[model samples]
Target: MKKLLLVLAGLLLVGCQSGVELRHGYWVDLRHPAQGARPRIKVIVIHYTAEDFPTSLATLTDQQVSAHYLIPRQPPQRDGKGVIWQLVPEQDLAWHAGSSFWRGATRINDTSIGIELVNNGYRSTLTGREWQAFSPQQIASLSALVKEVAQRYGIRPENIVGHSDIAPQRKQDPGPRFPWQYLAQQGVGAWPDASRVQHFLAGQTPRARVPVEKIMDLLQRYGYPVTPEMTPGQQQTVIAAFQMHFRPADYRGLPDAETAAIAAALLEKYGAAE
Candidate 1:
């Protein structure tokens, strides 16, 4: 009897230490301490796995790239039910954001928690035929997860961004159809004020040659990785990414009146902090 009691106690202790009581899933190791050993999480990077639900699960589990949660698209039910899989603990670093930067900080994989939603991405189609949107059920689950994690980590609304927002040139996941404005309405991330942009643009002189350097500076300030050595093609890519996020109505990759106006307004609104 004494030996059985001791064995049970040991098992309980092990379970507690492993945090296995929290959820059900295969937890894989992808640990890397942040530089300078910061204890706080500064960003929440959102992504869409450009694969089906099952394939994403296998890749995330087998490959080195991992995220804190995998919000899969379950089949729609009459009662509208869905589930979110917690693939990793929030406290550990997930190998998702690679060579990324935001708000002057680099190596975002260290300071950010990544959450991947299973969607086929824009390579599918603009009609969203190839990709799947989050069901009402899935959104509820995802919203709850975002709220829980953001509150726990003291993450700001602006810090919660799509993977493409941080690494625009190399990525386009969680594409334009991701309903970012809807998320912002829920206090998740920043949404540009279209009226403010229009007002700012109205004030600009006609055919004005706004400083390209200043526009680049504003993008870099907002964490877009605009460097001095960037070639014209690289510049266009970065600009296109910015347009995708801010001026989705037009993304011609040209620094036209509208793009310049938006960039100017953004600088006016948020550039002072930098």
Candidate 2:
């Protein structure tokens, strides 16, 4: 009876503390956490669901694709704030980033948390396709969530990226209208300094031809998955991806002074430190 009482007391104490619990019909004292360990979550990948809340929820829960959290376009109010859904736990892996690479890390799903926002993505109109804009409420909720997760994992500002950033060729979710600059203002992601960009921009005109190889080198240094084997078209796709993130005004995939300058500024701010 004493032995059983001691085990029960230990279990009760452990339940009150932050530690791993085992359930093999007995409780083991494991409260001493290892100092050499760190969280596997190093990156936070933002995405757009490309569907309504119901459809996105259904697809994420039923299908193979999943994310750590989902913010609805019109989230239900709770406690005077919007409510977001958590589809997957942070400790587990979510298959959101498929065939992706960033900062020399491939299979990004292994070490990242994915956040999905409900959006229609884009609609085809008479003139052209119109991309959807994220709601202010959605962005607010996302900012809060991202701040919390980044704090928990000590994720860097540059590590907070969109789905298109890690997989440029095949994906473009959380697209041009995602307001990356706004997020950068909130200290969530990377943004090139305007002054530095202008400093580089001052050296050349809009039509000045910057070599494609030099631009590619700058992008690779800034953390895109550019490689030597990529053809001209593929290289353009990569450049377009970079522009989509930094220079959303035009993403023609062609090298220009502004593009090169922005790349250089980003490298100067983020890459040089690393």
Candidate 3:
């Protein structure tokens, strides 16, 4: 009887061991299966490292700064397996999107996944432009990553944003050359509807038709952190962030016909969707 009991206990242990996987350890509990909360990933915040590959890696890994993934500005490898590096696991939090706000969420690091791209940000001079453009390989990998993450976490299109979009006053990484339109075309993020933009623009003079208060209300309604009583400087910073995402052709931080049109279009589409 004792020998039989020992054999049965060993078999039960083997069955439990075979049924579960734990990192560098062994444990088993048959309480429940497929039981856990869904991934808490609510937003995907894109950024540029503003440095070379090696430097970016070191800063993101060694320094306090970190992200869920890092895509270097390099061609895809033969196997296409190493286009991106997952520095931090998806289940963990990364110290990116510092002191940022979006759509009533503040300090968004708590619910956002950050992806850092390799490139130098914009330079001061125009003739001697120093900002490097993101490569095709990088964008392709980014699209795949964004789609995969969004599907897994049920992240909405409008939730895919840049660091600049969250922290407009301080950061502008993944700048105008980040190929946002391409990502939108690939169904990675939200793009302004052309008809809505045209409707906002057609037969409209930009002198002073829409009151500033109305514009501010619409901007806030569209997820920007704009307040009516904001200082002029603060208002410009927020507007510039909007332009960087929507109307990259001009991010001068001043409201114009194009800016108004784009802003209204975004509000009409995503405001309703959200």
Q: Can you write out model 2's per-residue Cα lDDT over 1-274, one digit (the tens) per residue?
A: 9999999888777775856566677656578868999889999999998898889999999768999999999888899788999999999999999999898889999999999999989889999879999999999899888988999899988899989889999988888898899988997888999999999899688546688998898888888998999999988988988888998888878988889999898888887423
lDDT of each: 0.72, 0.89, 0.82
Predicted candidate 3 versus true structure: per-residue lDDT over 39-94, tens digit per residue: 67899999999888999999999768999999988745767654689999988889
TM-score pick, better of 1 and 3: 3
Name the regions of candidate 1 deviating beyond 4 angstroms. 1-39, 75-82, 124-136, 203-211, 267-274
Q: What is the C-alpha lDDT profile of model 1 across 118-231, one tens digit per residue? A: 777754466633434655665666777787788887787768877877887788767656767777788676666777677867866533556667567667766677889988
Q: What would you estimate as the lDDT of candidate 3? A: 0.82
Error of 2 at 104 (Å): 0.4
Model 2 alpha-carbon drift over 4 Å, by segment: 1-36, 272-274
Residue 269 of model 3 has an lDDT of: 78
Choose 2 or 3, whichever is better by TM-score: 2
Measured by TM-score, the strongest candidate is: 2
Note the residue pairs that clash in candidate 2: none
Worst lDDT 10-window in candidate 3 = 20-29
